[model samples]
Target: MPKQIKLNPLSIYIHIPFCVSKCAYCDFISHRVGDFEINGGVEAYFNSLKTEISLYSGLLEKSKVRSIYIGGGTPSSVDGKFIHNLIMQLKSLANFSDEIEITLEVNPGTLTEEKLNHYIASGINRISMGLQTTNDQLLHKIGRIHSTNDFMTSYEAIKRAGIENLSLDLMFGLPGQTIKDIENAIHLVGILKPKHVSAYSLKIEEGTPLSESYQKGSITLPDEQLERDMYHLLINGLAEKGIMQYELSNFSSASFESKHNLVYWENEAYLGLGVSAHSKLNNERFSNTSRIYDYSKLLSEGKLPIVEKEFIDTSEDLFESIMLGLRLNKGVSINKLNQKYNIDFNVKYANALENLLKQGLVILTEDILKLTIKGMDLSNQVFLQFMED
Candidate 1:
């Protein structure tokens, strides 16, 4: 059983590792269901997950669940009954807030009216659908299993199911994406008017097919200037549609922001379940085994299946808190940092802060320190400045 500790309202993340097909740029721990009966695998996995949840029942019963995020290799690809059962089990084990946000990540290809209905019945109040791009040819190039029509059908079904809280994932910097492609996507999203939007730039992860193609000169990406232009265009476009950019890549209208993701950016504790899942609790971080077979084997023998664990110390904790907190538009509270860490935030990194301020990359007020527009664009460099020796 996991350790029992009192905390503020906790968030839960459930990983689903099954997908219909792997995208060319994907490197996450996911299995493609090709000619295999996914039901059996899903059942077995859920069984293990239940056992894992049971191990934390004591801690859960003592804590109120603030949010639940069901994510992964196309969570919509699996049977909705499995998801319903998982939510039911969690509810049985925990004290869920009446207004708790429960979100499920979905793919356009796997959505159905039946599934959406089941999801609604299961207490999933939010749907995050991946509609990476509106270009059918670009979608095909990325090995996406859905077309624009499929996305439209799924989106309509989500609305018909009475799910008002929706989040759409869009991507730029694709293999052949253009400014027009992004404009078209943003326009479509504007028409749909989802509560939230996550606009990201595609990165060619090493060892993925996309990276291989990039190295072989078969894949060409937008130049740095063009990519920057696309990012700004998306920001301006979404803003014009009344979507507030709350974080670097996430935008929302009023209270429709992603509560579960905010847990991470706020540096709060969360519990992760299933294969390759990660958890941060009690000032420690740990992760489950990545291999499904290994995860199953350990769980079957009544073990926790933890493959990695790190006990965060004070310095590391402070660093992480600042690093993650800076990702948000609200930025980090200087007062909170001083109160918690007992260090002069300005003095510790005076030189770095001076250089960043001179470049108009950051702003430091009496109570808050945050990235400016130029700072967000060069956030990586800003983040590097805060690293402790």
Candidate 2:
């Protein structure tokens, strides 16, 4: 009998870089919908995106796509038919897993019944909506286009449309945000009962409006201690609602975690299409050009619009696997790492492991290495210890 070979599973991420308006604290590669009208509009961008996906036809043949995520800048803002066509094209190009998980990111005040119908027809089993905060005043301060009522409307609409796996994105640490505000949001989560919730602290990136406001002392953000307190409250509150913590920033009901995101945290291979999207395939990592015009032009010319590429060596790959794996609650398996990297995990990081143990940051048991609750708070410092010196 001949030996059989198993193909590796792949995940796909498509970036839609158009939004109704940019948030005050957002630094992602996204532009206003009206601003790009002169540059051939969303239609042209979709065409370019289609071309980009077709470029990877050969790669698609060798791997089965297990998950597909259509993310920012508000994928739901654009016409849903484009998303449908994109998914249909992907289905034709590759061998989709029988239980493939397809997710689409949406925002409140942008979703309509017609759009929801189109998404349902497109095999979009999951929908992730951004409901940063329930406080209307805080929403305006952050430049969000929707209010709490808008979120409720959209939530009901998605549920009515029959999409069971829903995830909500929540933000904390905003200027003037209090623990009470997070509690309100958490209370809403309990009421709505989403399958997954991703709570993140706001990072004031330079060149953002929020950053400028802070620099001028016009806006005051929650101090570090307050921010930490808010995070702890969020964790405990969500857990009480049956949304247990799975990753550092992600909590979900049992069996309803974001599978697409898990692909990244596990250091698995995935393909990213569209402008500003990134990918990790085998040992190489690359990203598309962030400039919309440049991305469209390159794809139109039958060339990849990759602006950055890095071939991760063995040592770097090992470190990344450890860093990302620690983000999950189950942690990384030492036996799996040893088999994959062909190294004795204990012997390679004996000194760092000793220090981490002494500090009580991480625990290695039976062969699994996982972070303690405190380690999750200071994960950056813990990850720094494992870096190759």
Highest TM-score against the true fold, candidate: 2
Span of ten consecutive residues with least summed lDDT in model 1: 32-41
- The TM-scores, one per candidate, come to 0.96, 0.97
Residue 385 error for model 1, in Å? 0.9
Give per-residue CA lDDT, model 1, range 1-389, as digits (tens). 99876646899999999888989999998887543353577778888999889888888988899999998887888888889999999999898988999999998879777788789888999999999999999999888989999999989999889999999999988988999999999899889999999999999899998899899999799998888899999999998998989999999999998999999998888999999999999989999999988988898888998999999998998888888999999999988998898998888879988998999988989888899989999999999888878
Model 1, C-alpha of 206: deviation from truth (Å) = 1.6
lDDT of 2: 0.93
lDDT of 1 at 174: 92
Q: Write the per-residue lDDT of candidate 2 for residues 104-206, one digit (tens) a residue.
A: 9999999988899899998999999999999999999998989999999999999998998999999999999999999999999999999999999999899
**Deviation of model 1 at 212, angstroms:** 1.5
Error of 2 at 278 (Å): 0.8
